[model samples]
Target: MSPLLTVEELLALRSSGSPRLLDVRWKLGGPPGPDEFRAGHIPGAVYVDLDAQLASPGSSEAGRHPLPTAAAFQQSARSWGLNSSDTVVVYDDNGLLAAARLWWLLRWAGFDGEVRLLDGGLQAWKEAGQPLATGDEPAPAEGDVTLGEGKLPTVEVDEVPEFVENGGLLLDARPAGRFSGEVASIDPRPGHIPGAVSAPATGNLGDNGRFAAPDVLRRKFGDLGVSDDRAVGVYCGSGVTAAHDLLALAVAGFDADRVPLYPGSYSQWASRPDTPVATGPTEPPLIDAAEARRRVAEGAVLLDTRSPGGREKTGPIEGAIIVDRDNLDAEFDFGSAERHAEVASLQTPIVVICGSVNGSGPVAQNLIGRGFVNVAHVEGGAPAWHELDR
Candidate 1:
């Protein structure tokens, strides 16, 4: 069965019977998913916390986002009114990237019923002129279902090295810069698992933020040496995006039975001193004020990640283009499409200017995820530049 359903198809299904809907909207940094859910969501869509329901409490040993126990997940599933044969549809605002995590989790927890992603996600519904509801949704009756672990294969931290050594492929679903040790944002350490290949999860997305066509995905994976015959494993900063990659793998026709997830991912690997790390590519040195000016003079783009108004208040760093950080991954006018085209077409060096290394790090990495090869971020952000100016 197809793992995706269009908004139109979902509306048709609603006429016959409403499938269980799960709103899995979440962001990495802030603005809790519940707050976003309270603002507005599809009617009857129950909100699920990615950090709470989808993952266990944080542990250095298990990584930042550990998999929830089967019994605990079953309890949460029952709370959402799931049944053994219920058809479930999951979605999020940030494309289907976050939603796919829930979809994969259900299947991994031994769900027998059908699970599908709302192709293009909630934005698709809104784009189709659908109405939205605001406020906390009432809880449905408890569900009669059971869940167990090991239904979907997962590699333990201890087993990962052996799995990779046994000729299995381990794919890293993080941006190339992070994978290459050029930048480290969220995680404590830089670099990737020793033998993993860099395959950014965003690479699986199309211009419209939906998964690329199956043939395109197949070709993309083929280019990376992924095949049905080889045992494949996937990981990301945490396990979240890796699940999206796992879904993409299944979409590309790799047998779900064969592809397993490294749920601990880099968070666990980097924390453990015993595990080895491999850095890739030589990154351009972070530019200071003088170097930044020199680069700008040499045709580089000083990419300001502050809001246009914020940039105005902070004062520009001589020559900088205002491309707000929040809108870097957004859609339409605020999206990276035009910005990416502008950068790629120019083929110039881009130095991201933010509040600090942490602030600019993610923005630069996101650009790298979008295929921008030459990128860097201001070392200490605007404050340091201001200090230099004074």
Candidate 2:
């Protein structure tokens, strides 16, 4: 909970060289990283790839984009010249939302140093006639601080349902439509967990794309029934958008009781029939697994939910798109209402797949929520698909 840094405040730090900037955006399908930075980026800013720099390799236990190990994080900080003594400001494409997550990660890693989100993000910065450097950039100096295991709070999926049953406030960072089960999603199942409340993360953003003011966010959290001490869990399709809320909460002084992130989220929750889920205005969408898989392979697109590393390690389906569990917003932007309408060239059915059945299920359902119409989940994930093919 360092103080909020306005856009101007951050810019002043830039001029004084007191605050170092990190550009954290990447093209999902193209290049190893820093494509945007190479095109042009904030002067003297280092590049932090969301896929490589900020997250741990995906595991069955952690859906995707799990926090980097403390040592790895420390390594990254030092590589970027992020000493514990200086203020660090992060910016991303306004809509990408990776900027905010970077801020949260710093605090989670135990750096009490000042971390701020740039208002309007990089897009706004460019629009304001700010300068951006292109081609090559100068390398950053190594930082002096040693990275340590920082204390950050989080919870697992199995842990949250009980917390919910025990009166834990479940804040879903997706939209109301998706949460209420009014529509279907790309997963095989379409609906949310048993009794979760919707608090779409977008509410945390303002007209300018930066996070809302602390006071404004405090009230928003209040409306969602988040209390200072109430045990709470925030989730999105697969833990990415939800981080937006976690960051918002942090910014709003909920630091003393930072809410935990249910990494798998609805994406994981709805896959297993064992997990209690509500669908259809009161019921969670249910479908036969064999049939779901059959339909998916026949004509559907597979949406991969594992982290970027997970995809690389496990290998993706023959034609599946790489949509990290924590990156639904960007995924939506790349393949949603706007993108899909125009990319009519690819006329194939769509499917959602993750490392486990759990992550794919809800994402499938979420696509249905967005009126995707045709979707399903690969029964076991990469392993299943390979074994089945063999």
268-344, model 2: which lDDT tens digit per residue?
Answer: 67655577766642112333445446656544455667777777887766655666656555555545653433213
Clashes, model 1: 0
Each model's total of backbone clashes: 0, 29
TM for every model, in the order presented, reads 0.74, 0.65
Indicate which candidate wins on lDDT.
1
Q: How many angstroms is residue 144 displaced in model 1 relative to the true structure, after the best TM-score fit?
A: 1.0
Q: State which candidate has the highest TM-score.
A: 1
Question: How many pairs of residues in model 2 come into backbone collision?
Answer: 29
- CA shift of 93, model 2, Å: 0.9
